[model samples]
Target chain A: MSARRIVALSGGVGGAKLADGLMRVLPQDTLTVVVNTGDDFRHLGLHISPDIDTVLYTLCGLANPETGWGRRNETWQFMQALASLGGETWFRLGDADLAMHIERTRRLDSGQKLSSIVADCAHRLGIRAEVLPMTDAPVRTRVDTTEGRLDFQDYFVRRQCAPVVSGLRYDGAARAEPVHSAVAAIRSAAAILICPSNPYLSIAPMLAVPGLRQALRDAEAPVIAVSPLINGAAVKGPTAKIMAELGLPVCAPEIARHYGDLIDGFVLDERDAALADQIDIPVCLADTLMKDIDDRERVARASLAFAERLRAEMIA
Target chain B: MSARRIVALSGGVGGAKLADGLMRVLPQDTLTVVVNTGDDFRHLGLHISPDIDTVLYTLCGLANPETGWGRRNETWQFMQALASLGGETWFRLGDADLAMHIERTRRLDSGQKLSSIVADCAHRLGIRAEVLPMTDAPVRTRVDTTEGRLDFQDYFVRRQCAPVVSGLRYDGAARAEPVHSAVAAIRSAAAILICPSNPYLSIAPMLAVPGLRQALRDAEAPVIAVSPLINGAAVKGPTAKIMAELGLPVCAPEIARHYGDLIDGFVLDERDAALADQIDIPVCLADTLMKDIDDRERVARASLAFAERLRAEMIA
Candidate 1:
């Protein structure tokens, strides 16, 4: 098969690292990344897709290495001024990073399609990767926490994810139709890879989009999921705590099972290699700790090699 | 009168300089500046009041000297990306500057009044001088030109003011009422000083507001207009070129005629002192060249000193 096309699913930081790895291995235009829009929120009247921006900025070499999100060398003068002005500034908006949100919000207001604007933003940032939103429709990941149902930002930023999430719901998911690029990527894929992101908060929202999950399930391509949970903890964010809260084991097999029939194969970190046999799906063990650019590239190569092996088995 | 309250009418850039001077020289709460809003435009879905911000930044000690607009220490990454995105970025948005506009737009979208927002902005910037918009209504300065009518920004920035001005019109002024602060400033003022800004583009728009000119004409305050024209050239901007284009002499007395019965006095540059004797109103001559901070203070002091003389004449 002529250099196989691959589609990857992602959220923000953790997902972006794997996505970056995939980009390093895959040929230009060979990879299509479908990012979760569940974390998307309007802040200061600007439409901000945190995950999408993280992926885009990481791919474009603009992301801050220390934070693993937002642009490098970002200034907080605006936020400082906003705070001084008694404006709501819970979600920190870096000066350089804010321009993207502002332009996106502006274009969205001017009747442009979200996908087109995303494409425009990617092109402006000089990113070559195909970054697609899960859907054009707005889907908010609402957390029904102990503090009451709060918006994703309120739960994540305002409360510092301190609120115990009793349950999570992707608002507006029922009507969300997958974007044409997303569907096209899946249908024509050589393989589909799920990046190590929060399954409930990130991956679920994309799957919840009408017909998206079914498209992946029915595709001839092998579907591989990179476990976000390593050993007994989440590499980042609240995935492990959230899993425990929802009465699930904080292990690789548990995360693999979370995908159910949607995943044909799984990649677990070396730390969780011992538990790989417990999962029904074919599993590969590799170092998934993408701590730096080199680590990202190494993990990406392993994921690509794993996908290749799975695809060969599917052909056999 | 208790130390003579001073009200200054202003727009962006050139107006901000005098406003800065007034802020330095005038006692706290002694000056009320009614800034023009015709140059205000919505960019990236944010309501940007250029003149208001100019006055605010200048008064707060933040105006960039090199550009004569925007904040000091501003970064242009946002504008660079904005241009790359194929967005209409003729009006440059510096990264730091974008934050203020974004937050202001957000607050305005939340149904907050522009007056209150400006007040909050001034207070946050630690500016004691009152900065008020000429009117809260959406009024744009449209240039009726040989190249066809264009918005103020289009005429000024996009076209680089290359278009031959046939006439200038305030598109929404007939329906716009002066904001309460502007009216209150005019009514209770001990003296009203019009900054040496472009007459047709800046000051006329303020005057165009339905009853604003009438309010100034009837105010008990001695209204003084500083001539933007000096030595057959404008102190700043296209005042002289536009004046000549409109079939009027590029002279100080012509500015006096433009204001007509609205003023009790006029201030001219030393170069135009000879023509002051021929004007209908009482006139004063001073350097009126605000080249730096000290110059700004000098011009401000001179204007106030002139106001004092006008006040003394009225009292006598």
Candidate 2:
């Protein structure tokens, strides 16, 4: 058998946690993370890629353990100073975290592709695992809320997801081609893992990109999704609320159904083990709440094991 | 007499200290500082106005006392993180200082004039003294060096002003009109004071503008210049070296001669009082080294007194 190469699709915090776990469990060079750039926006003349930063920070051990986003030992002096200047400070930019935005924005302005910049930044930060943006082009996730269509950051950061999400649209995603590196990673992967990020806000945007979802569906790797929801509630973000708003059942099976036939197996929290029978595909139950590095690794291992089981079943 | 409405033309640290001193002594609404914008540059996609910021920070009491530039109690986490990402770090940008750059850049991108942004920032920072850029138009200082022509920051910052100066030119200054506020300040002023800043590098750039120099020459008020030089040397910067390289004497008279016909009086440091006789204009000798806030105020007061003497002489 060929060496195990796992590809993970991730959003900001929750997905970053699982991606970090996968990096720890898998060989140094075997893990490739395709991070969502749907949350990327220009704020205060900065190209802010929230999800990509979260993933990079997580994988490189720079992530704030408490908040699960931003860099550890972060200082809010930038935001404080910005606020004093009457600058828009609704979206907090920590001093350390600002480096990424500024450097990325600079690189972007200098004509470097986002994927190449992310790859270089990851390498510089000493992350052995490859990190790629979903696409090199812009793909903003617009949340169509009762308050009208709000930009992803407007809904997520500024408004704190207060407005009821009526629908979601990935603007430019249909035209945005998946980055070649990401497509190659998916194609050659031994297994693919859909991390426990908001299915709608995070993973769906990547799926919306032209040929990205189709590539994942066509990949020979056994695909498994870790449920962001456990016991009909999201551990983080507005995944549960979005699911409820969309008139879908806020459960692991519904999450599986959301992914549909793209995933061969599903990993749910042990708390949702009763719904295993309802999941059309094979299901693995584990404690999916990644509170610590240990829990992340455990959940990561379970997801990989589930993928292996499905691979075996397919072969039989 | 008309509330001592004074207009001071300034550069970076040296000029800013005097501007701050003038602000402290004069009525809150009396002093209008016109700062050189020749040092403004776009680095890492942030529009940085070194002299304007120096004047702003110094006047607002936010300047670092030790360095005489940037914000007091500034953080360097941004630079550290930026370095790790292999971003340019030749020009050190403190974290707190970055807010000004980012905010200014954003506002500039939004089509707001630089003078308006500076005024808004000053007002927000509790600064009562009006701070105006020399012009809204781009006027970059280029140093003609032995190493060939270099951008002002490239010469001053990156190279540490090491290259032997051949000449200096203010690009676009010939067509650049002085900002309306600065012109109005100069026109209505009781006296126009030229702060003790580099003649070739700072004040010259403002003077290079089409109508700005003529405005000073034709003003109703007496124009007085405080010499940047003391005892054949500058207290800071490469002003002395540039003066010597250009085949000019590095003394108070040289500084006076450089601003000939535009000024009615020149203020020289007490150390160079021996050369006071060589100055064509009435010369006032004072301790011009602004080592502290007290020193700044004393120098500012002396400049004002000299300007008053010149004004009286003009009336006589």
Residue A125, model 2: Cα distance from true site in angstroms: 0.7
lDDT of 1 at B65: 80
Give lDDT tens digits, candidate 1, residues B1-316: 2555788999888788888888787777788889999998876677888888888888888888888788898777667656666666778877667667877887888898888889888888889888888887899999999989999989988888888899999989999989987788789888888999988899999999977888898888788998787788875688888888889887889989999888888888998778977798888889888888898888888888888788888889
In candidate 1, stretches whose alpha carbon ends up further than 4 angstroms from where it belongs are A124-126
DockQ of 1: 0.52
Would you list the clashing residue pairs of candidate 2? none
Measured by lDDT, the strongest candidate is 2
Q: What are the Cα lDDT values of the candidates?
A: 0.85, 0.90
**With candidate 1 superimposed using the best TM-score fit, by how many Å does residue B40's alpha carbon deviate from the native?**
0.9
Candidate 2 chain A weakest ten by summed lDDT:
A1-10
Q: How many residue pairs clash in model 1?
A: 0
Model 2 clash count equals 0
Worst 10 residues of 1 chain B by lDDT: B78-87
Q: Please write out the lDDT profile of model 1 over residues A1-316, one tens digit for every residue.
A: 3566789999999999888888877787688889999999888788999999999988888888887678888777777766766778778878767777877887888898888888878877767678889888999999998779999989888887898889999999988899988888899998888999989889999988876887898889889999888788887899988888888887889888889988989999999888988899899899999888889888888877888889898899
